[model samples]
Target: MEHTGVVHKIIVAGIGPGNPDYLVPAACKAIAGAKALVGGRRALAQYAASDGAGQHIMAVTRDIEAVMAFIQEELHERDVVVMVSGDPGYYSLLDAIKRKFPSECIRVIPGISAMQLAFARMNLPWHDARLVSFHGRQPERSALLYQKGAVMGMLTDAKFTSRTIPLILMECGWPGEAKLHICTRLSYDDEKVVTIRLREAENYPEAKNGILLVEG
Candidate 1:
């Protein structure tokens, strides 16, 4: 839907692991020109300028309706940018945003996802990797994938942290001798990456955000 002659815009920008260096040029420019910024407190603090002139809205809840209303209200006046960590198209709020707003009203900018970086860090090509988001999802796998000797890249949240994921996989019939690579806080100052057997992953400490590279 058009906003009459106002021509307001909504940008769904991916900020990339909350690291300034990982911020793409387009995303950086979008934040600089944003009249209103919508994101979590940590993301805003990390990428946004301290003295920039923009109304910052904290989007901590899963209330898509509330976020949409705020964006629409802000768009009526000027352009609004919705900041999201990692790639917006990958298990992010992009789908909900698109559902709430019209195509003409939105612009999406991609960023380096942790999964992509994990593959890079491991010096592996990810063209054949099976991508999965275990965030807010129960661990499940297809029997066909198991038969094809697939490489899986999984995005992890608190509930499915690095340490607990291997246990879940073991229960799902995964072998204990499989190769497991855990990458946490990619591109950040305290980033950590470790390679271990699936059996050893149970003792590894968990991180708030991480990726698991599993090869069977």
Candidate 2:
């Protein structure tokens, strides 16, 4: 779909995980200067105290249609900014939006993703790490990517916590012998990182948003 008409320009910016410091200056300026802002609840919360004047739209899920419709409306008469969690390119809503809008009219501002923060906290070199997300689907496929001596970065859901992932790995024949680093609520005040053996993780409780790093 070719979006030709000048609605407002859509500035898709990433607001980091949940920390303001991680928010890049350019992204902060874009958001603060925009006439309108749109994103999920978590994204909106990060800018709750901003003095900038902009309308906020918090979608429940990946309601691309609704978000696009809102974007179209904003483009008609104002400079619009959309906030996405982590980097917009990392399994985010950017691709869908870009599919509908022309590239010339859309600008993307990248931010620090949870995977980066997770690896940073663990002091692990992620150059060879494989990243995956189980946020809206089953993590079985993701588990298969975890091979011996390979580093795996995973985005997990509430139901699939630090512990649940090990169960999946065990079922997939992942040698019950790997180091597991589970980062939950990354970049947030209550953030916690737990390390355990793949077999021991099964006994842990569930967490909110999680990033699992498995290596052998």
Candidate 3:
């Protein structure tokens, strides 16, 4: 619990989906001043400039142990900043890092999560909604949650997206009559929001870094 002289604490910051406007000032400042940056390939590309004068660790498909070791090494040399998509605390790598480091030796900077942006764009109230992410797990769970009429909000992957999600729902005996909202590339210039039913979504194209909102 005591973190004296532990200036090498891990800093987990969310950089939002893609829009710089949604990036918190504190997160931006941290990235701007960081001496080392660690994140997935997508996150690295979003904040490419941060690697100009710092060590950049692309954690694409790397094991969690590798990520933790990378962070540990960075902390020994300079101030390290781990950039994550959306809020770091939202099904991100922050938890794993925290488990390896003491709470007092970590700083978290929150950014606008994709779930919040998705609901906001749809003008829907999410207080009563259920949110889930298929980022690092099976998408089947999202389908099951959607069937329960929880106004499901999900972070989809390339392998499991709007196209595949609906198919899974149908196979799981979902009502098949719910409204589907595919919010893709949120907060970016190429943002797209497609509305369709469960059946129609089965044929929709897969999108990366997108959110699926299901309403009955």
Q: For candidate 1, give the lDDT of residue 61.
A: 68
* Clashes per candidate, residues 3 or more apart or on different chains: 0, 2, 0
Q: Candidate 1: lDDT over CA atoms?
A: 0.80
- Quick one: best lDDT, which candidate? 1
Per residue, candidate 3 scores C-alpha lDDT tens digits across 116-157 of 999999999999887776665774453464345568788888
Which lDDT tens digits does candidate 2 get at residues 95-204? 88888888778889999999999999999999987777777777556446546688888888877667676788777667677888888878878888988788877676
TM-score of every model versus the real structure: 0.89, 0.88, 0.82
Score residue 213 of candidate 1 by CA lDDT. Answer: 90
Stretches of candidate 1 off by over 4 Å are: 1-6, 52-58, 143-145, 206-208
What are the per-residue Cα lDDT tens digits for candidate 1 across 5-124? 547888889988767888899999998877788888788777566776545565646777788788878887788898888899898888887877777878999988888889999998
C-alpha lDDT of all candidate models, in order: 0.80, 0.78, 0.78
Quote the positional error of residue 194 for candidate 3 in Å.
Answer: 1.0
- Which residue pairs show backbone clashes in model 3? none
Q: Which residue pairs of candidate 2 clash?
A: 7-75, 8-75
Q: Considering lDDT, which of the candidate structures 2 and 3 is the better prediction for this target? A: 2
Higher lDDT: candidate 1 or 3? 1
